[model samples]
Target: MSKIGNDHLTETRDHLINEIDSLSESQLNWKSNLESWSIAQVCHHLVLVEESTIKAIAWGVKAGEPTQSERKKVEQHILDRTKKIIAPKIVEPDTKLFEMQQIKDLLNDSRIKLHSLLSTVEDKSMLAKKSVKHPALGELRLDQWIEQIYLHEQRHIEQIKEIRSLYEELTEAFSSDHIQ
Candidate 1:
């Protein structure tokens, strides 16, 4: 695995932990509206995505035919929150409310699985040659799939921040109303 890819994965995971470290159970589960995902839901969705991504990468590396295609610059595209991409059913979070510790444990378990898989791959260059088809991004190499995990998490980090802001506003309004 590329050092850059590993670094990005570690960075995003740490950032995610920091983002939700102080959130209360209620805060983690509070949604702006029925249609919006709560922070807990977002974290759950990320866990699902990471697990699925690891499977895809493993499959591609083991079964895929090698190719000479270059990696696409998909970081910018993945990070663009303006474009709303619906989560696939397989990766969607359910209605379960997750405690902060639960979320962190799930995140850590997925990260461990991912790192273990990466460590076992003896030929790192093989990752660049193996390919899998992405729904929106076309064919991506096994290595690119690894990168996608972090890039996708970064997108949802922004969403988590937005949810936090909305929660703060709602609480402040509620407090103001009680004072009056």
Candidate 2:
């Protein structure tokens, strides 16, 4: 396993775990607007994306041909706060709001699968092979895909925080009205 890749996966997983731990069930289900995802939905989406992307990476590796396009260094552009990319319909969150424990279990299971895949790579250089075609980003290697998963989690961290902020605002307003 690439220590760096595993480290990133672990770090992002922990950060997500901590972020959602304090939120109440109502907060988790709250959306800032009709168009936005709730915290629960975002968490669910992360689980879906991580699992599918890992599978795609594994499938690409087994298929075994280096991509024709020269692999450029994969940057963490997904983490950019200023830019927004539309999620492909395949990855859109399920309508049901998942329980917190269920979301955590799914996330952990996906991470374990990811670690297992990384362990099979004997040479770190295979990361540059660009073996898989991502729905949004086109061809990417296993390592880059792994990095993208973490970066995608980071992107949703901001959304989760925004959800929390809006939830807090609503709570405060309701509290003040009751007091009045």
Candidate 3:
């Protein structure tokens, strides 16, 4: 992966950390609606995603070869928020609640593992020599998989913001109810 890609990944990670750090335990676990995921769930889902993506990419790099394709363009599709898709069940977050610190630790560990693996690569071209399968996007080489990881986190960052808004609204409403 390119240095810029790594920078983007770290930037998104920092943003996620900041966003979660600002929430209280109740806010982290609050759901805006019956169908929406709590911020904690979103963080847990991201942890699962990064862990799985890195593992799959590492395995593919060791055991397989990349296929010819426009990986960059295909991976860019993941950044489009208007295009909604379901996540594979294997990567789904646990329904159990998570503490903010626990989520932070998982994210931090995952980042370290990923950065360590990618940093060991002396030739960027080698990324193209291997590929992994994304449940929704199908086959993606290492570079594309890296890009998708960031894009996926970004999508959830937006979700986190929405959850923040909902939490604020709910808190305001509850506070008002006791004002009289």
- For each candidate, C-alpha RMSD in Å? 1.0, 1.8, 1.8
User: Per lDDT, what order, best first?
Assistant: 1, 3, 2
Provide the global lDDT of candidate 3 against the true structure: 0.81
Clashing pairs in 1: none
Off by over 4 Å in 1: none
What would the TM-score be for candidate 3 when compared with the true structure? 0.91
List the global CA lDDT of all models: 0.90, 0.80, 0.81
Tell me the spans in candidate 2 whose CA falls farther than 4 Å from its real position: 72-76
lDDT of 3 at 169: 84
Which parts of model 3 are misplaced by more than 4 Å?
Answer: 64-66, 72-76
lDDT, candidate 3, 33-152, per-residue tens: 777788998888888889888787778767645566556575457767788777788777787787888888988988888888777777778787677677887777778888888888
Instruction: Kindly list the per-residue Cα lDDT of model 1 for residues 8-111, writing each as its tens digit.
Output: 99999899899999999999999998899999999999999999988988888788469766788889779888898889899989897888888999999999
Q: Against the true structure, what is each candidate's TM-score?
A: 0.96, 0.90, 0.91
Q: In candidate 3, which residue pairs get closer than 3 Å at backbone N, Cα or C atoms, i.e. clash?
A: none
Report the C-alpha lDDT of model 2 over 67-177, residue by residue, as the tens digit. 655553555567776877888887889877767888888888988887788678676576666467787777766667888888889888887888888889899999999
Question: Candidate 3's error at 154, in angstroms?
Answer: 1.0
